[model samples]
Target: MPSYLSPGVYPRETDFSFYVKQISTSSAAMVGVAEKGPINKPTLVTSWEQFLKTFGGYINEGYLAYAARAFFDNGGSVLYVCRVAHYADPTDRNTLSGQKAAAKLVSQMDMYLLNGDPDPLPPQEVYDVFAINEGIWANRLEVQIENVGLSGGTFLLSVIYKGETVERFTDVSSDENATDFVELRVNGVSDYITIHDIWEPVGDTGMGTPRGGTYALSGGENGVVDMADSDYIGDPSQHTGLFAFDEVDALNLLMVPGVTTVPVINAGIGYAESRKDLLFIADAPPMLEPLDVVNFRKGQGTYTHAAFNSSYAALYYPWLEISDPVTAQKKNIPPSGAVAGCCARSDQKTHVWWAPAGIDRGRIFNALTVAYKTSRGERDVLYPEGINTIAVFPDTGINIWGQKTLQSQPSAVDRVNVRRLMMYIEEAISESSRFVVFEPNNPQTWRALGRLINPFLQDIKEKGGLYDYAFQCDEETNTPVVIDRNEMMARVFVKPTKTAEFIELNFILSGTGAVFSELIP
Candidate 1:
């Protein structure tokens, strides 16, 4: 409010327009073991090549690299990769024994007492060199040092991996305060190794520099041995494993690729449901018969009392077969990665309300075949149990054939499209409505909220995401008691657009004299 004294006319500017910012619903996140990278960190990589450069190439121990490659090949454009590894003790990083290989570079200097007697101290360590990440790949790296400059006070450092020079730093000094100190030159910038200067000047002794020699890093380990379910469902407080995704702001889908253990799947479901925004793409074990898959879904047979039922999760069965880039042999891996990519493609090509299954949008790339080619009868058994099938057809190659969520109770949300559509709308609106938090809870504010939200829902309605929607933010919903409680309430009612999973056609043959209009009626 503004006050004016003795003013004939007053001018004021007002803003009457409000809008909801559109949110992206295509980004996805995955958790798995990698060959080498920052462990338990949610690193975003937009392309397969970037993932490889950051996380290293495929390893024989884990299916992470394979799934990541399949994701990008299948049409996923943005992915957040969280690399998990086993540790003997989760609280102490030092217990990550043998994870990081290291070597100590020493400076040999002849020292004597003032009375011309030899000093008893041995050579002093000048620098400690460590691999950039924890993995066996760093064991092959060798560091080379050479004395340089007129005074020979600085050294040239070269890092070689498998006899190929990967990094070189010249005129690097051991002095901690020097502009070209070894730590400053190589710690963050070098891709292969990091250097720590430990050299300290001894009183009246000759200044020491790193001895010129080639030293190979040792004691490196992959740290994936004896991995347990707890490793994948890491401590949420520490933000490791599935919880590492907490660092990501917006994720539409989640996966722990190739890990289909009952405990892990259950953990992932609970986590996704708690987030209320993303869908967890779960995997059935590879090479399971149709009956076995059904039994698994029903908490019977091999699974023996484990079941999954959630609108925030979808399970896909029968692994996909792709030629391994590292082994050059056909391998069967989980389908969640490829399915996530299909969901992303569907969101991009159409609306989130559209089913991601069927031939047009569910075709998987980089996969040669399915582990099990299910028959129509088998699909009938699988689909009803909420296990999505990756069917391989002679004419259509490999495509996702179902879109049911793990939800056992049949309803509109039992389908993946409807569940995801609700997630998208709810997340987008709730996120964009933060501005109305401290505004006055009056008719003007209520109308402002309506003006902000109605068009957004209308846009979704017009785009086929919703059949219809209604929004109310007034005394009926936010009465005096609610306003007095310092709360503003808005009611959003939506009829989500449903997918046509089954289409029926009726044909009639009429006599030549029969009228077409009478037959139609």
Candidate 2:
């Protein structure tokens, strides 16, 4: 056949139709084959122990393998795996399910809280006023209308309903500022009461605005923020701060990535035999250090667990798992829980937080308040609106804010010494609204201010950089910001620069001095 292929057009060769018969069909083609494991097992079984877990949790159910195989057999072309955690705890439910069991227990708890009514505990019936009356389709947000006060005189209102300052107004009707007054805004946000309910002066016994033992804190201006790094009271910083150390021991409980150390604060009151945490908890323990044993006692079943989120105030506001100003500022007693124990106050800026002034001076709030300066004259006001927030300068020399008792009057009155210190901040080169920052060429001062502002303004503002940082800018610069001791003095002497009320803007350029906030580890 090879020689016959030369004559296809004119000369005839062997017929092509006979060629298929000569060549075997089976031997005609060659194909590559993929290898597989020795043959027959169908389903892959996985042991419970084979499941992956992390951080006291299970991640893989192993059903993924079967799904993957099925998908491979079907039309699923390709897929990728996403790591995850099993949110549902599959402990034990037996014939039922673990989730069902947990759900049953939780439902029973809800039922118990429901007391007898369809609503959960019938809102506890503690003189409820106004909350969204939502957050609960079938439950209610128990509210208390307390600390209503007069501003100028007619009938201003201090409307506190369900953990919020709904509104505040200046009652210019009467010349005197009434201590207790509540004006209900009929149509606004917390429209709990009416104009008629605004000024109902019941009596002193019934109307005396609750004060934390009438102890208003005040402190002279110190140009530095307050900082507290208390680990174990018997540890190091407590000795430097001259705070009392007894009762609760220090702990390494609180920890962050780079920061490791926490103050173990003891709540004074506890059950006769039982309590939470290794250290005992109580409303107030005797011979306490940082603050007076005064507590705005709380009653049973009153406060929610959302208030304890703040590490500093967790001991006093044990019921709060949330760090809201409204809940943190409230006064407390025995079961009614309030951390009236400690504070950081300057004549200008006073911050009230929860760490009680107990024997464990190593406590965060305790360390902060003790080192904080107390005013000889008036308080230093930082922001125009009442300050409901607090921050510590990590490795900074000072701690700010403390056991502050707010007045029923809109303008907070310090029952204890309170001040906010700002330090070694770069001074204003000129008198304009803005200025350049001094380079931290001096390593000592660099570390001083550098340590002072961290964990707070780390990403936002570097230690020594361009002073012109817009609130939301992401650029880094090398401008200097000087500590205007004069500005601090001005805050003490002149009225707050910005406010809805009157305007009083004066400058104290001379005689202003710089202060340092020291935090000894």
Candidate 3:
């Protein structure tokens, strides 16, 4: 409110137009073992090349690199990758220790400062560089240093990887205030390594001697240990493993890629459900028969982890045969990565409410075949058990054949499309209604909420996400008792559109002499 003490006329302009900001629903997050990268840090890479640049190339048996490549190849636009490692694995953590070189100073002026006779603080030698990640890849790295034009305090540095110079710093000085101080210039900018420390010897021992030389980094080795659930579901307080994703703001899909153990998969499901904004795509263990999948879905399998039956998680069976990046030979890998990409593509081409299945939108990329040849009878058994199937079609190549959540209680959420549609609507409405938190509890505020939500629902209906919807926030819903308690009420009725997976056509036989109009009626 504004007050005017002495004024004939007051002019005011008020703007009341506000709209909901739609959340991004296509990003994905994953945690897995990698050959080299920051340990347990969530790094966002938008393209396959960027992932490789950060995490290195594919390993002989590692699937995270291959999965990341497949994700980008299948139309996923953004991914947050977390790398897990074992403590005993060979690493390059403290490989950069340099010895101090003598400094040029008059002996008389280099006495101890205790009696104010002189200041005696020797300069410490800083290691030129060390690998940014732990792996044999660092052994390919080389650091070269040289004096620049015989200058007093200036030097040049060059970093080489795989026989090619990747980074260079010219005229860098040991002085802290120099325009191109060696430590400041190379620590944060260079991807291969960071400058560890710098030092000089005491009392003119090695003062004028050039410490220019080329050195190769060593002590990087890939560990030989399998990842466990503890590695994937890292400590929440430390934000490692799946907990690393908490640092991220938005991602609507999650995949653990290679680890298909029941415990890890179950952990992923619970984590996804807790987040409430994304769904987990679980991959079945490789070579599992169709009967095994059915048994697994029915909660009668011999696996140690409990079966999860919820809309937040969906399971996919059979591995995908795709060409390996290193060998270019077909290799069977889990389908979780490809499934997530298809979901992203569907969300972009259609609405998130639409299922990412069938031939049109579910076609997978860079896939040669599936690990199993599923029959129609097998699909019939699996679909009812809430397992999404990947099958090969005559001309469509490899396609995601089924779309259903693990929700098997016979509710509308049993269908993936309906469940995701509800998620979308809930997120959008919840975000838009946040402004009503402290607004007046009068009819005006209620009407404003209705105005904000009805149009959004109408848009979804028009886009085929909803068959019909009604937004009710009138006096009847928010009675006097509700108003007195500082609360508002709204009832939203929505009939979500269902995907047509099966259709039956019946033809009736009529007598030859029957009239055409009568037969039609």
Candidate 4:
């Protein structure tokens, strides 16, 4: 309200409409190992080519690149990747110095005294070149420097990887004040390398020109030899590894490819439960028989003490065999990545409440076969224990045959679709109702909230997400006592739509003389 002591005419405007803005339910995140990229940082990649450009190509050490390829090949449009590596010096966690590859360039010119006497100092180092990340892949890179335009102050630098020239900079100077300074031009622009000019210039003459020769970068280590589950499940305070995703706001799915230890899976489930917005996809150990898998799920056999029971996580069985794009050979990998892609695909083709299984939406796009083919009896045994099986049929290829969370109890939320639907509705409504926080605790404000929420729930019900819903926000919920405490309250009850996981058919035989009309009853 504005006060006007003396006014002839006044104009005022007010906004009365409020609606819920739909949030995306398809974006995903992953924590894994890469050949080259910023360590413990969340990097966004939209396509397979962009991933290769940022993080190096395929490697034999980890399954990160393979999983990323499978994700893009299916239907995933956006992904946030966090690359992790073991520390070179575990005691020093403040610097990434000893884990990178670097080289130095020395001055080629000879200096003389004013009396025409030769100086005693030998050639000094001028510029330092380092790989953009910490990995052994940069060891194959070579930098070439050439004098340009008859000026000893400026030069051209060429970066070559595997004997192929990838990047070249022309007329770059060593002077810090120049517009074409090497550090200013190449620090954040070059995709492969970063430069630092460390030479001290003499009076008025930039005489520390680097020698025209090639230098090879060395001392790069991949840092995966001592990698452990603790490295992937890093400290939340430091924001490393899995905790690096804490900075991201709208992640809907999470995966740590090929790092499927029991401790790590348990930590992931706990993290997802705390966030209350995303689902964690878990993978079973590869190459287990049907009975062995059941025992593993039940904490028997080899896995004597390991078990999983959570509605925020789902366990997938049997690795997938896909043709290796780098080596042109078949490779067996975990099923979590492909399953995530199928979920994203389902969310795109239909609503998030729809089941992402069966033949229609659960087809594995990048897999040639499943590592272990399960029969009908095997699937029946696996599904009841809450292990979603990637089964192979004669003509249907490989498809996700079940959609069950790790919850051992039999309930509506034990199914993946119901749990995800509730999460979606809860997240959408809670985010949109923030506007009524400090408003007056009266019927007008309560009705305003109902007006904003009823349409959103009705829309979901129309889209086959709910069977029915009831919303109440009035004096009954926000009583006189609640008003005295400066509080507001509301309650919403909903019946979620369940998926059809089983079908039944009955067959009977009738006599030849029986009447068709009489038999119909």
Candidate 5:
């Protein structure tokens, strides 16, 4: 029955009980929060048994290993494990869970790419993976997937630091320009990753680079490289070291849209970090020679196989920006027994990437960051902290993709790279391309350094002055010669070894420069 109310308000039936059991029941049962001090972060997986149950279906012999991996990927600081007992029963799921539960989380975690267990006297484990862009190893992320428990294949792992937050760049979805849901992505998250949708994703639309021009690089304000060398090396004259162009840099060309042919996926995953700037990546371009490479931002710098063959030789995109994985299951295990030796995709070099945006920020890279003496003789981290991102290109096969088996290196890097570079020198000489072995073979060097002969390269004295060089691509003779005139910005390199007498290297020397996504790309 409704209450008969006059001008005054009537009593509502919502009276709650607070003191009903005050004496009998204490205050701890109501709110489980601690009184204060250092608080523990809430964990998604509460119990070891529950975690094992949930992941066993998607797991193998590894339960705790995979969970630790996800936690590290999302920037977990302290891990309080409850290791119950010791058990080597790989297939026993219950045994594994009980053992893991007994372990407590490590309160202070230092995140690094290649971190081996701190067992007695283990030399720093090397876990570095690399990316193959254009059949060449370019982006190198030095990291190791420590715990062995995750699916393998081509994957990009991202991480979002717990103490850090960044806005994602995206379009406003509302009809009226409302600033509610911004488009963005970070390093660490629950599981699924989100990417923003953009119109005309690649510059192949009306916004691509123009022909006959070059990619423009934006340098940080107040820096300079020589002018003659600048035009020759595909480098730019900008303050921020970013390449700018009226069109796409030929290196970043995507599939020509509207051609009905499948659009090649360039820039697979783009991440915009807050402590840093935007990070972007393009999938390896196709194997077609005379391939049109497009640079996204500058909308400039168009070239073909001829450019890579002669003029521009030392460029290969290798690393990728991805979330870090805690589990090392089914990942690429280098012959060296190192977890983070190479990328999970092709097994070259694996690393976490950050977009070092401002003066206050920097990025991470592969390789144990030891305090190394720089050329200036000052000690510094091999890679700096606060670094958000970095870009590295390897010189390898530019025609194909895939990992190097026990038999051979990635053909795109080995075969195509060999022939391409040799073709130039072959044209300059009268002989056909042939790898000549003149010296007695030494097994120690090969055993020590493998096929990497660059370390034995003799030093060439630098004569600094304005020099000239040209890429004489004889479409007729099927050869190209990069003529180093008096030797300007680039130099002729030959690495002599016991097995392979002379290996080739053409170093395109340039001042400090950086690679960034073009605002226009």
Candidate 6:
């Protein structure tokens, strides 16, 4: 209330309809190789077209692009893509460094094609330009500079790719202080190439240099030099590889396309466990047999990392055959991306407590077939070991057949939906209950805490997220002795609805024409 100096009437505003915040559960993160994007940077892409515009289309070296396509094709809404590449050489720097080297003024015409090195440094001044990203895709870029008779060292610059002019800059200058200076105009504007250097033409006679025409760029390398485990794990300090996703918020799912190594899998599983809300969707190695997959889950023979299992991780078997958008050829790739998409779609259509598996929710898009079709008995072996199966039906298409987590124990958390529901509830309530901190440690505060959490649990129950739930924050749970230590406690009990993984039907044959009333009874 404001200080009412000689006031007759005053009103106050108070909010009473507070509820739990809706924590996002459909957000997913993936880390892998890309041809042309900022390396080791997590870029948010909401649609397939946006992903294509930012990261380009599919390439043979990495399956991240294909996975992203599958994700969007199956109704996924949010994705954070992290691009990682193995730099083959030290010369593979970003556009800024290359531009600084090119900015060194000199008079030279000693020409070097893109990626063609050993060209002599220009004695005269010229501007050297390079592609904006590090990859072979830069080979398609070319720049054209023309002297348009503008005063004060002004000129016209055009950027071209694959015979099409993409960008045009008019009245640009070599003067660094000018408003339309070439570097200032193009550094953040041009998507294709950056101005690398500015130097004098070798034969310039002061009547203004010739147009200088067009120069095609080369020497761009994909930098995918045989990825190792360390490349995928990445450095947290440098924010490379998987650590690139540290910038993303509310990422509840993690997937690494085309990477199934033991160390990488262990790292991902451990990371999910650390986050407590993230679920790891694991992809099996390509060309492995069903028995091999079972053995892999058992951590036997050449397969490992199964020992690092938790309720946070779930493994899917067999690759998928989908047509390549670029080549239009059928190719087999990992199923982790499509599985992630199905999880997100399930969370969108139903609650996160609902299983993402089964015929209705597990349909994958752009899939032609599974690489290895498993039999009922094979899945019977795989499911108990916490390995989900991707099976192909005669008319129903490919479906995710199992829903168990990688927690190889006989606990309720082994079920995917139950585990996810618990995580969802914990995150939601934990965020909503922060107001209870530092309040009066009396019955009023305890009751208030219960009042805040009970409604959230009740909402979940109403939405079928839980079969039953109980929230306790009373005197018995937060006693006087406990309060004396400046500690408050709340206990939550939940019975999550389990999916019907197995069904049994019994039939008893009776004499023909037996009494219908007796049979009904």
The lDDT per prediction is: 0.85, 0.21, 0.77, 0.85, 0.19, 0.79
RMSD each, Å: 2.1, 34.5, 5.8, 2.5, 34.8, 5.5
Worst-scoring 10-residue span by lDDT in model 6: 95-104
lDDT of 1 by residue, 75-175 (tens): 89999998888867765545653377899987745444578566645666777889988889899999998764435468899999989998889888766
Question: For model 2, how does the per-residue alpha-carbon lDDT over 253-294 read when each residue is reduced to its tens digit?
Answer: 110111111222321111101211111122222222212211
Native RMSD of candidate 6 (Å): 5.5
Q: Largest TM-score belongs to which candidate?
A: 1
Q: How close to the true structure is residue 249 of candidate 2, measured as C-alpha lDDT? A: 24
Cα TM-score per model? 0.95, 0.15, 0.87, 0.93, 0.15, 0.87
> Can you tell me which runs of candidate 4 are displaced by over 4 Å?
1-12, 88-92, 95-98, 112-120, 149-152, 511-521
lDDT of 5 by residue, 1-521 (tens): 78676678666683222111101000000000111111111123333344332222222222233333322222222222211111123223232111000101110112233467554332221111111111001111111112221221111222122222222222212111223221222213212122222222131221111111111111111011111111111222221001221122111111111111111111111101110111111212322111122221112245222111111111122222222243532231101101111111111121111111111121222222211112211111111111111222243211112111111222322221222222223232212111212312233322222122212111111111112222221222221232222111122344211112125986654445634343225
lDDT of 3 by residue, 1-521 (tens): 77878958888884456565688878899888776778778999999888988988887646888788778878798899987765422233222121111122111112355777565655334443567766677877777777643444567778888999999888776555566666789888888877744444443423422357676777666542554467777667667678889978787888899787777878888888887878888888888999898777665767545566888889998899987767878899889888888888888898898888888788899888999979989999888888889999888889999888887688878787787788778887888889999999888888888878888888889999888999889899999999899899999999999989897888888888878797676
Backbone atom clashes (below 3 Å) for every candidate? 0, 100, 11, 0, 110, 22
Give lDDT: candidate 5, residue 171.
24
Candidate 3 stretches greater than 4 Å from native? 4-7, 87-125, 148-151, 198-210, 222-226, 474-487, 507-517
Predicted candidate 4 versus true structure: per-residue lDDT over 17-108, tens digit per residue: 89887987877888888899988899999888989988888888788888888888778878899888875443335733327789999876
Where does model 5 exceed 4 Å of error? 1-5, 10-361, 365-521
